[model samples]
Target chain A: MDHRQEDQFEYQLKSALHRQEPPNGFTVRVLARLEPARPEPWPQPWLHLPSLRWALACALGIAVFAGGWMFQQERRRAEGEAARQQVMLALRITGAKMQLAEARVRHLSER
Target chain B: MKRTLLSVSIVVAAAICAPAQTIKVPESWDKLAAKADDVVNVSLDKKMLQFASKFMEEDENEKHLVSKLNGIYVHSLEFKNEGEFTESDVDPIRTQLQGPEWIHIVDVHNKTERENVVIYLKMVNNQSLGMAILVEEPKELTFVHLDGPISPGDLSDLSGSFGIPKNLHVSEKETSKPKAEIKK
Candidate 1:
């Protein structure tokens, strides 16, 4: 067929396929269909909550407190041990001097 | 006259009942320790003594005295040369100890060696309450005072680590890292 006749035929076919007036609620229906799925925001606001933050903070605080308590106990234990050693050493010397003094007294007595 | 005598007797009896005075160690002795080459200035009060008793092993002789000790004062000063300390330095301490509640237990004199050891005990009601030992050597001066109930027999038996003698050689001990060497 001729170019003019073909153009006229294509226009008539497009017009026949196109809607003259949209159906009732056609815009609303199309818009609703076009609307993306809400997907419930991935994580439910209840599932990943503020309470979880509080729980994490409490756990970290407990761990820190326990570590500090253990450190303090260890330091006190070390101090007590050092004091013990000093006392024992001092006592030993005292005993030795006592023995020497006694020996000297015996020597004098013998003389 | 009888009443006056009775009143005086009551007062004297009351004075004897009074608790013994705390031995006042001169601050000069403490200062001397600060100046010495090495000093063992341990003064454990009642609470500290109780704490120290926990570290001590279960020995009858040691426990007998260790449990009774209310205080421990040790001031030992070592010098680089002979005649570092004089009689005048220790005379004041000797004088203080000469007062009431004290008795000379033993005195050892070795003039040739320049080593003299004097031991004194504080007595109350025939029971020993405390002890003091003064060792005056040419090179060192040591003063050890243990306050509380003690027995001479028990003290003589006391030594280091059960039965180990504390006679560690001075030169070897000075080379040792941490152990205390009893310098005679």
Candidate 2:
């Protein structure tokens, strides 16, 4: 073939290889597969509500109050028990002393 | 009429004279005075040095007043307020108590009220034989001088005078009972 005809053929082959074009039915197939995504119903959104935070804080407060009240009651009970023990000890001592004194008095009377 | 009147007067005089027939006054003031001296001499202020002297003079019956219980020589106890007692007031007493026979027992503090309680006990042969004093200060102060034979077992009894009641069940019952009752 002549050089001019050969050059034209090479140019035509290069252009064909480099050219860009949309694939056949590419856009339509993607749109058909998507099916509108159904919007996902927005995920309930309760975690973001103000009432949930309020409920959590109130529960924590109530738990803390209950713990504090129980602690106070236990402390007071312990104190009362301690006081009772002290009183008991004192009384026992007094009784013993009185008995000793009585013995002495009796001994003296007999003498 | 005159004879009846004279008889009535004689009977009245005899009746009046009957009560005076057996009455007699005894001279016992000297004995009483001596006893008063004994009590005063053994008082807290003067007892320490005088104790040995007075104890020596006690009769057999009176000697038992100073009990030697559990190897302890317990003599007497005296209670007084702090205002009525000064450091100097107790100096002579304390000096005698601190003799070789006695040992320091306990000294405690009330941190909240800044008060103190001091106690001393006497020991012979490593056995508690006597008590010296118990001083408690809580705004007002109470000083107790317990001189007598004491034992470890007697400690509870000694502490009782300060309102520490023994027999918890009995005290509980007594305290729980109402002091007064009302009738509708």
Specify the highest-lDDT model's number: 1
Candidate 1 stretches greater than 4 Å from native:
A1-47, A109-111, B1-21, B27-35, B57-64, B156-184
Instruction: Compose the digit string of candidate 1's lDDT tens values, residues B1-184.
Output: 0000011222232245442336655566656555566555555665555665666666655655666787666667776678667787788888888766677655666887788887777777667788788998877788888888864644545645432244422232222223222223
Tens-place lDDT per residue, model 1, A1-92, is: 99999999999999889967777899989879877753456555664778986787799999999999999988766655655655665686
Instruction: Report the TM-score of chain B alone for all candidates.
Output: 0.68, 0.38
Query: lDDT tens digits, residues A18-73, model 2?
Result: 96868999888888877786566664577568899789789999999999999998
lDDT of each: 0.64, 0.39
Q: Mark the 10 consecutive residues where model 2 chain A has the least summed lDDT.
A: A83-92
Q: Which candidate leads the pack in TM-score? A: 1
Tell me how far the alpha carbon of residue B162 in candidate 1 is from the true structure, in angstroms, after superposition: 7.8
* Retained true contacts (fraction), each candidate: 0.31, 0.03
The positional error of residue A60 in candidate 1, measured at the CA in angstroms, is 2.2
TM-score versus the correct structure, for each prediction = 0.63, 0.28
RMSD list, candidates in order:
18.2, 31.3
